[model samples]
Target: MTVVAPPTLAPPPPPGAYKDPKASAVASRAWRWLWLPLLILVLVIAGASVVFIVDLDSSDTGTLNPHSYRPDGGNALRVLTEQYGTPVDTPSTSADALKAGLGGDVTLLIPDTAPLSVRTIQSLKALPPSTRVVLLAPDRGALHVLFPDLDFGDFPATSPVAPNCDAPEAKAAGSIDFDGAGYLPKTIHAAHVTSCYQGGLLLVSDSTGPEFALLGDANLLTNEHLTGYGHAALGINLLSTHSRVEWLYLDQPESASSEGGDGSQALFPPWVDAASLYLILAGVLVALWQARRLGVPVPEPLPVVVRSAETVEGRARLYRRAGARKLAAESLRGGALARITPALGLGADPDPRALIIALAQRSGRTTQEIHRLLYSPPPTDDQGLLALATELDRLVDDYLTQLTIGRAGADQGNNPEGPQQ
Candidate 1:
């Protein structure tokens, strides 16, 4: 009997992304081994994309979590859009547009009601003198809380540029003439913006040459400000005076690997966010391994997941113990065919004679007969069943050997994962 290779077709593309018939690969004697690597690849991809979206694992950079704000949406993209009714553009982003927004442009950024970080404060302070300034950051670290109920009369009416406000911080902030005198710049969206939160410091600085406006907190830029209840208008109003004003938005990127959190006192110390991932992986693996051992439900037994192979193995063992070889052989043949038909391009209900004819036509098989070798009666005894299993085994080996050559050809850069086997 001479064995020949089957017809070669173009290799299939990736599965799931593009559902190909090839993805439902035909199985054989050693076919189960391939799924182990496939399963591992799937697990790795799922774990990486879903889990590391924000809580990344890298030592160099930090994550800029868009969703971590006190409110649901306080990320840089939303911040720029809601504030200016436009996409983001900043000194760092589009420097060419700088001259357009300068020269009598005034813009304000209030971190008052929200928590304002020291870095945020320094960045805001770095604006030009012509730009207006308002220091509304309260104790929350970012300007999140704005004083609404507080009366103007109750305000100290003194220069708040002392230790608390940006007064002393101005020198370090490197503002031009911020150490000198200047008048308060008014904004169109003041009352509406102010109504949302408490008041912070009102600063007047140069945004560009001849441009000026206010800077302070409606609440203050806090990490905890909720959506639809923010003082975004106040920031816009501060910038409204500019004939052509641009908000110098400082946005944190979304996929950073490192960031600061409550890690100092975290229970897991060095691995704050990674603990949950490990626990889930361990649990899933344990469940799969112990699925059969606890297949028959008992009182207080944990859950498990049984793969098709394990289920088959369990049934085979039971049949052997009961001395039912014929039944066992029938099951074994059915399982083996279930894997092979798809692999060899024979339909699910392939007639053994037709399969032989097709194989002969496609791969030039000459005298290899698969009738008694494939669809014989179930074994009547232990020896017969073992013989049937052995026949099934050889058929599987031949099919796989042919499949390996096909795979090798497909992988010469013309295909991705070789021919679907």
Candidate 2:
């Protein structure tokens, strides 16, 4: 009646107890160095962030900004305009510019980088006839917004040209820089347009609307080029004509509505759409023509029975007609090796030396004879090829006969009784 104690099972060995030492060392080394790459990645991201922040801060002083002090900024021109007794109002948005223009006798300075909305265009068109509007480097889209009858013409001259026109502003600011687009009038309204600086500057004094001045280049007003030639005089003359100037300064690009009519489709020729449709249709037709397949393969019986021996003989005759003695010798030798290697218990790709040794041992032939019969150069003529084929057949037959005798002898020895005593 004694209490018996139960035997406890041994605790399981620690995890990965049987893992290979090499694999364990590799895993340990991997984990130990894992933090190095992570540290590098973090430093790279931090460095990139610092660079991006510096660039972003520098970008605030952009081109055409009236208050920007950078070389590309228009701060100098703004100071000159103010010094001429005309106060400049910096407006970053189109709405603010239009609102500023509401005051009596204000000049609206629109840079090419300013985003023009339809509402802003219409509002500018409705301004008082006395309010002057100056457009700097206006592209075709902006021109269409203001003057539907005008488009960009030939490229402007690279060198500065004289202001030969009779316009009072061009006459006063003689020999201004003209290194941008030139204008061409498309309709009868061309009569009202006065061009200066070789068509680089245009003044449209339409009796029915406000006076418009188009400056083909923005470089003329930048701080870097303001003092060059008569650029300062031209900028001050155009902008200071009114008592107040509304300068549009855009820090970032604004997204304009599609109604502004700057679509890429207008750039292509009229026949492009039709040609694209025809090409697409032709491609589809070609794909269908090539992809159509006949019905699944149909297996049929041969009309006549052909033996394997006949097939081999036919192939041999073809080789002989083609004068392929080397190829014929190779085939005969390869067939002999294929049959003998398996009977000798050698692998499909046994070493050449080992195979020659095994063949010599089994057939009682010299290694040189076996090697020559198997690995010698191909025959040069039909008679040599025939002799080589005969030798290969004899080698294969002798190997097989030796293999049969060895197996029969082993079987008799294992039978335990004397053979038919």
Could you tell me the TM-score of candidate 1? 0.32
Off by over 4 Å in 2: 1-56, 156-158, 185-191, 255-421
Question: What is candidate 2's lDDT per residue for 235-302, written digit by digit as tens?
Answer: 99999888899888766555444223444556689899999999999999999999898899999998
lDDT of each: 0.42, 0.76
Per-prediction TM-score, please? 0.32, 0.47
Point to the candidate with the largest lDDT. 2
Candidate 2 similarity to native, TM-score? 0.47
Local error of candidate 2 at 403, Å? 99
Kindly list the per-residue Cα lDDT of model 1 for residues 1-421, writing each as its tens digit: 2334454433222222221122223333246678798899999999888777755532112112232343322354236444655333334322223333334244343222133334334344344555544333233233222222322212223432332333333323221111222222233223222211112334322323222222332222233332222233333344344443343333432121111233234445667458877999999999898874545656774488778899878987899899976556656666666766786676777655555555444332332334455444456777888877886787667666666665656555586555688
